[model samples]
Target: MSTLGQRFSRWMQSRTLTGLTPGPHDITIRKDLRVPMDDGVDLLADLITPIGETDPRLPTIVIRGPYGRRGPVAGEARALAREGFPVLFQSCRGTWGSGGVFTPQVDEQRDGLATHRWVREQPWFTGSVATFGPSYMGYTQWAVAADPELAPDALCLLVTMPDFGAITWDNGAFALRNALGWTQMMDRMIRRDMLPLGLAMIRPDPKLGRAFGVLPLSDGDTAATGRAVHWYQDWVGHERLTDEYWTQQSHTASVPSVTAPVNMITGWYDIFLPWQLRNHAQLAAAGRAPRLTIGAWGHTSRGMGGVAVGEAVAFLKEQFAGVPSGRTALVRAYRTGEEEWHDLPAWPPPGVAAEAWNLHADGRLSTEPTAGGVTAYVYDPADPTPAVGGPSLLPNSGPVDNAAHESRADVTVFRGEVLTEPVTVAGEPVARIQFRSSQPSADVFVRICDVHPDGRSMTVCDGIRRVVSDDGFDEVTVSLWPTFHRFDAGHRISVQVSSGAHPRYARNPGSGSPAFDAVTLHRAEQEISHDEFRPSFLDLPVWAG
Candidate 1:
């Protein structure tokens, strides 16, 4: 280690985790230890270990990510270490005290393997290894698992995407809100060391209203970051989902090859919920089955890990001791509206079937197709429909009431009669619309809500489809985020149809003009036509068994 590294390690050893005490064991904090890489660079890591355990070599767990290695996870690491297990908390190759340039989603395999190798070399390390963390940390665990030579014995992952494109190009529209919010935070993290306190103290969410409103999205990165975030700009520059840029950065390509058992934890309204849920099916298709639990929460549900850590430890202990965990089911999903957890044998719960509730012309949804007409609205780019609540990373994002946005003229809502009995929807919801747009291009934003007896409609989930084909008409399928919800007696179900969701998805200017750059704003005349001949409806996943 360099003199600076040595001094930093000494300083780290003396430091206590802010607002948290050390664990119950005679714990030792060895910080800033350098793990050597193949190319002669060393990455920084900290170890929390028990001082006087009977075993000289102990089973281990690792958490690696770009964020500060010791800030949020240190307490968790200490606690795990006190349970007679070694915990390794390491910064990714580039970030914090590590010795590499910071890049996202592209460099975890080599560094992850190096850290695992470093751990095995320690006198206190056992042969068995496991990995656990959330978000980017969870991603790092997956990235590392891609390597057969370095796969951990078990995994505990939370709230992460299978591929980067899911967040970059969600359901065919640019994920403007998520990209902007995340990159802005990263910009601050990168600059804090070099900037003076006066200059460094950027607000956590600095003027996102103005930043995301910038046109020609190429400039949006500079507007949000004060300087160009190359990755953000790269995402903006490559707007197509079919672009090779997204495919090259995808981690899903290597996901199926991983053989270790995985424990996945996620939120119902998490920003990555769509992609994370997709991963479960993907894994099953690839002959790998992972344990899962989805909760009723949003993106920043880190505290959920506490209850889950015990489960992780139990799983790891079983794996480390050559015992298989006799888990029967594949999923444990939380029912949101009812606020209850349901242990299931499979996703979509065995016999759940789709029930098409037909969209009608008289501003009502019914089981029978009895009406024929069109509900039309003019979508103005200048006054686009605002995104209220759904699966987003923004403030106040989740299952909030949608009454405020429902009143907008550009938004058309179709209501259903009050249900005499309870209706439980347990999986993905699909909206198949037989529609037309006056302009050459447009967007269809669809949302499902549960209307209380008193008429308060709370959003369940939403989706958007950008249509470029204006061939007189088209049928667009908008897949809403999956949910475990129940509409009780006297409550009604409704669908909110609109042309845009504003910054959550980049608004369609309705002109077929170049992506998000065109200033030519066309007032799109939107129409939803449903009749006996042409029926538009919502295919809700009604639980059958």
Candidate 2:
């Protein structure tokens, strides 16, 4: 084992089980089992079995991931094992205690199929299996499900989206600023040494190292250190949105071939919300049994405490109980002061209607139709509007606060009159815009919020559109992620339109140059239209919920 893995194992042994407490019945834990792949690479796995002398074979849940297989999914595996399901937590071919160099999702497809095949041949195999996890783990489940020979009985995907190009590398852009930090952390593991790399790269303080269990980067010539640098450079070199490189790497192209029943779980505040919705839509449209559940939480919130573990357990039970009926059971829960879970036959709800709110000349949003007039705003890239609230990388709870950001002069705030009745928007919020820019390119950011009577405004849904691809007088439709928000009586609906939402999304330099080295900024004269010919308006999915 690598030094870091050895240390982590010792720590787990000490913390997970103390002196002689009886372990759970119907579950036996075994670590460091080798499973050979088709490519002759032996992958390491930790198996959790439901002990039964007569029926050693039990329904299985396979969680194949790049993150330490023994780490993130440990809690879920233990919980599932206790529920009478054998959970196999396997490290990806080249991650953690596994043998090989980590190369992200490229190896996952073959390794996942091999792992499933190996699991079926085991003495404890029950001929029934399901794949589940979040993010990369979730993507692996989909990839394995796409394999014709290894189609699992069910797939429970959490917070993973379809199309790497659209979401993961949106138009060939990395969403998370912590990508570098994550790469560095993984590099340390690959080199078999846990050098306090992320902390050193971010803050470079030795004192902070103690808190994070990180050792100084100078401590050892860890393989992870070198891997991190290489990964960062590789990511930087690829700049085109639709290059042959990205086309071959994308896994969504295989979605049409997947036959396993899919259960997608996402969060409203997740950075990949839009992509998750698209995945659900595609799967459902392809005549597959697909279900979707979205909550008002971040990437790690559902596992931590925001949502109840029982909810996920119930979902799994439902999927494994019977064959999917080619029907979608859509549910959306919002953390609106308290948790509210609502069920619908379809996304956006069948009875729900689209309400168009137009931007008036006097900075007012209303249902009234306007004449041939336009609302204009000056976009200055030097002092762009700072990002506040929305689905960002920062570790926090509840909805994000964008009130302070609204005060900026550069941010154009358009507000509709307070609603006399409560209104709920439950689906994808779209902004149909007809605008002309003075420069060759510009970025348009739209934020939807519910303004309370007390003057507090909480963000609901937001979207961004890079106008560089658009012609001067072309109309564009920007679709914001779906949201569930209750606009109380006397509370108004507002849209904060601006040029940029920095950091959350890399600032569009407006130079019509490459994403990496393009630093030149151009001023633009933007004109927003709301009329019959160029009927630009915000389409809010008004739901009864």
Candidate 3:
């Protein structure tokens, strides 16, 4: 087993791995591992192991997901198996070859437990097991970890969340585009399973564009996917986090029961970055120091120019042997602008200072606060501000230059002077604004950017908030997800204020009614104020070192 120190030393010495190399041992594949569940339904899996060994059992790594057992997972299973680590690629119920209906987010806990139990009973099991995968597959690890009897020895999770709401709803606004896209993907999986010959490709949804514009958000699922996704309908119908439906499906409900070492992998632009942070915090609070790795990429690509498998493999090796990870930091984040990775002994590190930049009349952001200034913008849902990109899982995700969008009159832009010195930030930025709107309800979308000397606005991180209006000036606070970035000298800090990140978040409708049933669209006149009474400011987390 390799400790964290030993692994980091090796990683620092030679960081030139293209893809994981398989071990010298010839491997054999078993296409059917029928894992019986409590309900008597068998979940199907493909098992990969060393060809000739049968007496000395090997460690197991189970990747149970709704994704098919043979498609995306076969290569991964082969590679891990080649390295002497046997892998079980299991399919979630009703999709691929698994039994029972496929209701997303439900049945994962029990199904995961059953599969793990079956693995331990097999002769090839070394009595040590770990769970791995991204998205819902990652959830399977946590689900089983919650069960003391079935919990894996370790967990290697990637770009996934412990709860669905964090992906579909953030700060009170519905995540329209992500929810629709994901539902469509799952719907296609089921149809393809039934008609493999004809449904070669998930036929494009003709109602896609108009579907997003549907009056009732709840009914938009069938319009977009051309089929009924019951879980999605349930998602849009129950908008409250307080709903019993969500509470029962939430994976965090099992956090206290998870005692295994966990390696949490996520990207800066990953849709569930915020939720991953929440998971890290909850684990720490439970007295578990899980390892974390954040990079500068989106949901699909772990990192554009970097690979994480080496570190992940090392982490798993340590866990499987019941060996300590050794002295180390909790966070290992790749700073975006700097294009470098740094280790923080603790998240937000120690001795971090909070610097405030006040918004002023000239669209200037500085330490000097100006008096009696108001900036206004018109928010039209039909012509709502589109998502420019920061954190998202939709078709158009990752970082896109926002200069063109910032040039629009509908966006209120505030910028600071070129930096005379460099500034490093390792946590979420906070925006406190005194706001007023013509309507009784509104949505506020905010972004923090790095204004290059050449005038290009590169987004660092962004956030959105849905406000139930008081019809007057009211203070609102929004927090961007935690980030690791540094603005070099001569770079300017910028803040953008707008009404909506349409399709990214469902348009607020401005009617103060149910978002789904909103028929009439109204334009809103919004104002951002800064003065003695209402001094609006953007809080930056500056690291001393």
Query: Across residues 121-215, which tens digit of lDDT does each residue of candidate 1 receive?
Result: 88867777888887888888877786767788888887886577767776767778888877876767766533532242343345666887787
Q: Is candidate 1 or candidate 3 better by TM-score?
A: 3
Each prediction's RMSD to truth: 4.8, 6.5, 5.4
Query: Compared with the true structure, what per-residue lDDT tens digits does model 2 show for residues 145-213?
Result: 777778788777887754444553444334423343455556666765655744554454343222122
lDDT of 3 by residue, 1-545 (tens): 13564344234323333454444445667887788999999888988775544323346889988878765445555556655688888999987878999988788888888788888889878778877777788877777787767788888888788788756768888988778867776787777744532242345445665777776787788787766688888888777877888888887767766888888888888888877887888888888968988877687662321244555566766655534545277788888788998888766678788998888878999987567778888999878788777666543356677899998889989998889998888788889888988887898888988888888898888888888787678888988877788899999989998999877788877877876567788899999888766788888899877
Clashes of 1: 0
- In candidate 1, where is summed lDDT lowest over 10 consecutive residues? 13-22
Number of backbone-clashing residue pairs for each candidate, in the order shown: 0, 3, 3
**Predictions in order: lDDT:** 0.76, 0.66, 0.77
Candidate 2, residue 144: the lDDT equals 71
- Write down the lDDT that model 3 would get: 0.77
lDDT of 3 at 411: 92
